[model samples]
Target: MIKHNVISVVLGGGKGSRLYPLTHQRSKPAVPIAGKYRLVDIPISNCLNSGYNRIFVLTQYNSASLNSHIKNTYNFSVFSKGFVEILAAEQTNEGERWYQGTADAVRHLQRYLQHHDYEHLLILSGDQLYQIDFQEMIEAHIETGAEISVATIPVNAKDATSFGILKSDEAGNITSFIEKPNSSLLPPWESEVNDEMKAVGRVYLASMGIYVFNKSILTQILEESEGVDFGKELLPEAIGRYKIHSYQYPGYWTDIGNIDSFFEANIGLTDDIPQFNLFDRNTIFSRARMLPPSKVSGTTLDNVVIADGCIVAAERIERSVIGIRSRIGVGSVIKTTYMMGSDFYQTLHEIEDARANGFPLVGVGENCYIENAILDKSCCIGDNVRITGGAHLADGDFDTHAIRDGIVVVKKRAILPAGTVIG
Candidate 1:
């Protein structure tokens, strides 16, 4: 069975500098998305739904929150030989350093991996949004007898440069591979573009960073090569020496590798029918929390997703994803924003004391006008605050917020003074 043969490893990314402030308190994988679930849940859920239960998450930087979330969320029955475990970077007889890159992270865990009985290792990115059945890819790998199988998708030229490009022969065997190729160096498109692709314009094959490797071949490659990363090092080297194949996935997939992409992916959920459907009863899975239903009073909401325990008294809110336990004051207008909401609710006494001390509680305040922005968890915005991501800022780092792809990001637990204006 696929469950007995495949061991899934989800890579928790390195110090997520691009997703700062959000990554400030939690690891990139632990960062919340779509109101309630964490980013790491995607890959783990996919593996589980696809009949693969043995999963190991590799993490190093800011892993406290990530570890907690995993511990609290994923628990398998002992009767079944299935478990989701965290393999943190540790000092051992083999090495004394942290994970250097993707390959190195897996290489360091070779000792533990050797103890597990499996035929293939499924490598996945922790911060991507998509639903895939790994069984299909596994079957393709077995059918082709491939030493390594890489999952790929068609991407336009504008987005191709951000991913590793690949060229495959008629049999779907990868002939060439390049990491983040320059536009000038990209090979011409050899495959025909379907009508759906034609509507989006020219397209090229791009790696999804999802790989399935034969256990023996993987062990051999890690031991023989000094490559630290898969995309930048190991994969390109394996193109000619090994039986490298490609599996094309024609579904919605987005890599949340940076702030701009993360912002867009979350906001995109407000669509009438999103490309990535969280409401699907069959595919997606995450931590299930038990809390009172969200309460909204005198608020005008449109295309919004309000999570559990949220209290909203705003005048108008449009196209927003409000997380659990969020509080919005009266007369406030939230448009095109993601409020991560709070981890825990403030006690009545704490709110009263904060009010007496002239400090705003952890939420949006009265008459605030916010648009195209991300308010991280537990942030306090005082009365009459206005935040608009209207400026064409490619990138910026400020005291109160950072601007990425024209979206204003207020850091986690940040406090803003009353009547503050940010653009």
Candidate 2:
């Protein structure tokens, strides 16, 4: 199933302003999720799992960590030609400025793409959570003799307005497209969906931002079009010019657009039967860290997902995700939180020195209660600290943390003093 003729290009999105502190130091793709894996792992894993190995990730904003992660994690055998490389935006002779949008980014990198031998190109977004088989879409594209194919999902009228909706004929051929239409103009845009989807009021076909394109057609469009974005300008124009097909995807898919959605997506992993299954046959590959097993003592855990190299002595932890090398002191109560663990463990000497200086040590201290919060990497919560986040608190950003949509997000490497309380 090695798809040597197809090459994948994952678009590491722009500044990621909506996901602000998380994307402050790192790119969108490098943001951590599920306690251990990065956000970029979703699309790269989908590509690798579908037997397409040649990948080039196009990145522009804060791409150092993303580049390092890909280089260290995805090295194929010397006998195989599989590779995952990063193509950062640079000041070329043709263009000195940065990439303006998605289509502009791909258009700027066409010269580098010419060196690779591929028949079809698979375009993916970096900040989405879904498990899909791109081979099925590719097969449908070839079978229907389509020059371009878009992966679409059935969404309700309310949700369709936020996405690019497409209308397809009975033969699965796309007839028209619109980007984020208004509710008043939605009457004629409803496409046919299955009974199950229709029963749930999901009749509009929304673009998933996943596309398959014949190489020649893609090259031609890029060369002739000066459009900056695909959804905003390119795809809408190509609907009638090309034989575009709609590949309907009927599985679980959620866009990790902002802090609220990102928090819920991680917290959802603690569910008994989560929508995005992580334990399925498709493995999400990441950097293999050599760490010891987690050790928990005197803690009553309920529906929590903890990663490797953790030491916990909490009184109770309910519905939470604790990341690697996390340490929770005795008598703490954690509920509905995501604690991204430390990058490197602190030795006893360092911890003692920090405590002697009246500074908070890395990880949570004794008798702390943290609920509905996200503790970023290497955060130090002192003893007797309490953080209860909910609608009672207004949205604001502070020196140490930010509250958005009733969720408190402690900034990376922030320090909370002893006896501090937040709500």
TM-score top scorer: 2
TM-score for each predicted model, relative to the true structure: 0.97, 0.98
Count clashes in each candidate, considering only residues at least 3 apart in sequence or on different chains.
0, 0
How well does candidate 2 match the true structure in TM-score terms?
A: 0.98
lDDT of each: 0.90, 0.92
| Model 1 poorest 10 in a row by lDDT | 185-194
Per-residue accuracy of model 2 over 1-423 as CA lDDT, tens digit each: 444489999999999988888888899999999989999999999999999999989999999989889988999999998999899999988989888988998898789888989999999999999999888888889989999999999999888898999899988999999999999989899887889999999999999999898999999998878998888888998988999999999899988889999999999999999999998999999999999999999999999999999999999999999999999999999999999998989999998898889988889999999999999989999999999999899999998899989999999899999999999
**Model 1's TM-score against the true structure:** 0.97
Prediction 1 global C-alpha lDDT: 0.90
